[model samples]
Each structure stands twice: as C-alpha cells, then as structure tokens.
Target: MSTWLFDLGNTRLKCAPLRDDGSIGEVVAIAHDDAGAWLDALPTGEVACIASVASDARRVELLDALCARFARLHRVRTEAALGPLRIAYAESAHLGVDRFLAMLGLCGAHAALVVGVGTALTVDLLDAAGRHRGGRIAPSPQLMREVLHARAAQLPAAGGEYAEFADDTDHALASGCEGAALALVERSLCAAHDLLGETPSLHLHGGGAETLRARLPAHAWTPEAVLLGLARWHVLRIA
Candidate 1:
C-alpha cells in the first residue's frame, strides 16, 4: 500500500510519497488558495499522513478534498511527548505542529538550533536528550517587506540586494528587514551556545531559508525537515 506525507503550512502545502525504505520522496509544494485545481492531479494513495499549521477552515477544505483520494488520513498534532522528543510548552497544543516536527527531524545525538524561515521566522532549541528548550517567533523578511509595502505603498515590496549599509530606499528596506532576521538568528545561536555550554548545530528550513542560509554557510539546510519528521512520526505509531 502506498503512503504519502503532507505538510500544510500557512502559505504552502508540501507533499511527497513515502518510499519503501521509509524516506520521503521528492516534494511537491502547492499554494493552499489555489490547491483545489491540483488535487485531482495527485496520485491516489492508501494512506495520507498530514501535519498542518494552516487555519481550521483551510484544513477542513483540504481534508474534504482528500477524503475520496486516500483510504485513511492521519492528522498529526503537537504532543507533550513523542518518542524521544519532549516538548517544552506548558500547553503543547499552542506550539505549531510544523515547529514540533521540524525539531523532531533535526534532533539527534547533538544539540541543535532549528530555524524556520517562511511567512514567519521561528527558532527553537533542542538538547541532545530531545528536550525542547522553547523558541521565538518573528516576522520573516518577506513578511516584513509585505507588511511594510502594505502600510506604505511607496516602498517596493520585492527587489533590492542585501547590504550592511544600503544607499537607496529599496536596498535600505531589504537590508533593514533581512538584517533584523539575520541578527535574530545570530543572537539565538549565541544564546544557544551559552545555554548549552557548547555550540549547537544549526538547522535551517522553510521557503525563505535559502536567503539566510546563503549568509550562514555552516548551517545545515533540510528543506524537507517537516516531511521527514512526519515519516518518523508514522513509523513510530505503526511500530
């Protein structure tokens, strides 16, 4: 029987087939607002495992669409404890499942600082023992640009190179927004080092990660971290 993994985030829906060896296959990302037309094109499978951070209405719409396409649907949620991972949240439900799963995918022998750059900038720290040490959330550079452009139409929303000191308005906007996000990640790394008494491995993911990853070359980039974690979640459940 075929099984597929779905990661539904605020801006995109990423899906991939589960390979026989339990690894995730190539990922296909779709915009939630325009996903209806593409649903029928997806290969019908025996089971669909989904981890979603989209709104309730959007999730229902997707579930309704996939009802007939898969024999069973496994929707994953944030848990206080899952396998080796122990979430730090007092109310686990408040933590986005994407963040939880991303940590799961990145967690291993060493401590890690997981950074997600998408519609929002999110950072979480996980110790070697799989204990989540909490995290921070801020507006992503793209989102900051969008909000600024929306508030002030004169500022261009997209375009401009990142610079330490930008001469023009467009570059200034880009520099300021991107700089803020970069500073946050750097600060988190410093704090993680101090907290752990050792430099934790940095893991980057999400659509906006490439820009940040470019600046920080040493960090690991796992674009499919969420899906990989979902696969792990499924295996543990069925084991």
Candidate 2:
C-alpha cells in the first residue's frame, strides 16, 4: 500500500507516491481532467492518502474514485500536517490547507520564502520570528505568455530551452514576458528580504518554477525545493 499526494495547481497537477516507510518513490504530473483515468492507468495498490485542490466537481469525483480504490483517503485539508510544518493561514480554516502544509517545508531559523508558481505565482513569506506575514499572487508564466501573445504583434517563439535572440519585436515580447516573470520572482524574493530586514530563504515550487529557475537570483530553490518538501511531507507522517 502507498499514499498518493497530489498537488493540483492552476494549470497542472503533480502526484507523488509515498511508501509506508516515508519514502517518496515517484513523482509525476498529468492534466487536471485526466486524474481519474490517470490513476486507473496505474497498477492498483491501496492508496493511503489523497490530496487535491483541483475543482469542486472534479475533486468530488476524484475523492470518490480514490476512496473506492483505497481504504484510507486523506485529502489534504489546510490544517492537515504536510512535509515538515504546521499550516497557519490568515483565514486559518478558510485558506486552502495545502499552502499552509507546504509552508512548513518553507520555514527555517532564517526567514522563509514559500512560493507556488503555477497558473498563478503565489509568493508567501514566513518571517524568522515564525510569523505568517501573508503573501502576494501574481500572473503565472502562462498568463504572462498569453498576455504577451495578445499584446505583441510579432513576438518570436520562446520556451524550449534558453537562447539569445535578436532584439526584434518577437524577441522583445519573449524577453519582456520571460524577463517579467523572472523579475517577478526576483522582485518578490528581494521584497521579502527587504521587508524582513534579513535575507529570506527562497523555496520555489509549482509547475512553472523550473523554467524560471535559471533566470532567478541565487536563493531560488525550484524543483529541488518542491521534491525535497514532498519527501519531507512523507517523512513527517505515515512512516
């Protein structure tokens, strides 16, 4: 039997397998609508837990399906323990519990930066004094791309690996869009540090993180941060 931990972001969904001994066996992603069928395509094993922020109807369907598939289905609630820390949303109960749980992994003796960069980029700050000082949400990489595509008349195609381009219309659009996103991360990290009056520990997660990691400043922990946090989540519980 294994637990299924799912992080459903705005544009994509990420899933991980956690063994009883607190090991993260596999991590992957799939389209949001395919969640039900996605699990059906996998080998059957008891699902110890299930977490989602997918959608109202979709969540109900997935929960029902997961419950049918496993005896225990622990849908991650805001207060639910995840990775390493307890979640404390400003609204407390109203906040999506996953953010809270994920923050636990973001916190340290130094100020912590917990960012979920998906269809929207949410940058949260946890001060060194253990304060959940709220956060901000900005356009995600996709949103930025769409904005550029709509506004720019002849922007060059970007993505599919980094490269230098002529500073033409397309290049400007691509660079501005990508640069804006990169600047958003850098800006938020710097702002967090400025507000906290100390260097904040940066931990970036969610779908768009990796694409922007190279363009970010020194503290950005994109893929590794999320993977390590997911692994930590497993160790904290069900071990």
Candidate whose lDDT is highest: 1
Q: Residues 113-222, candidate 2, lDDT per residue (tens digit)? A: 77776667777788776567777778876677776667874543354334355446555555666676777767877787778787787777776677777777666564
Q: Candidate 2, residue 24: CA error in Å?
A: 1.9
Task: Give the Cα lDDT of each candidate.
Answer: 0.88, 0.62
Candidate 1: deviation at residue 84, Å? 1.3
lDDT by residue for model 1 over 151-223, one digit each (tens)?
Answer: 9999999999899999999999889999999999999999999999988999999999887767773888899
Stretches of candidate 2 exceeding 4 Å from the true structure? 34-36, 80-89, 147-166, 220-239
Runs in model 1 deviating more than 4 A are: none
Clash pairs (backbone) in predicted model 2 = 78-97, 83-233, 155-170, 156-170
Provide TM-scores for the models: 0.96, 0.77
Please give the range of 10 consecutive residues that has the lowest summed lDDT in model 2.
79-88
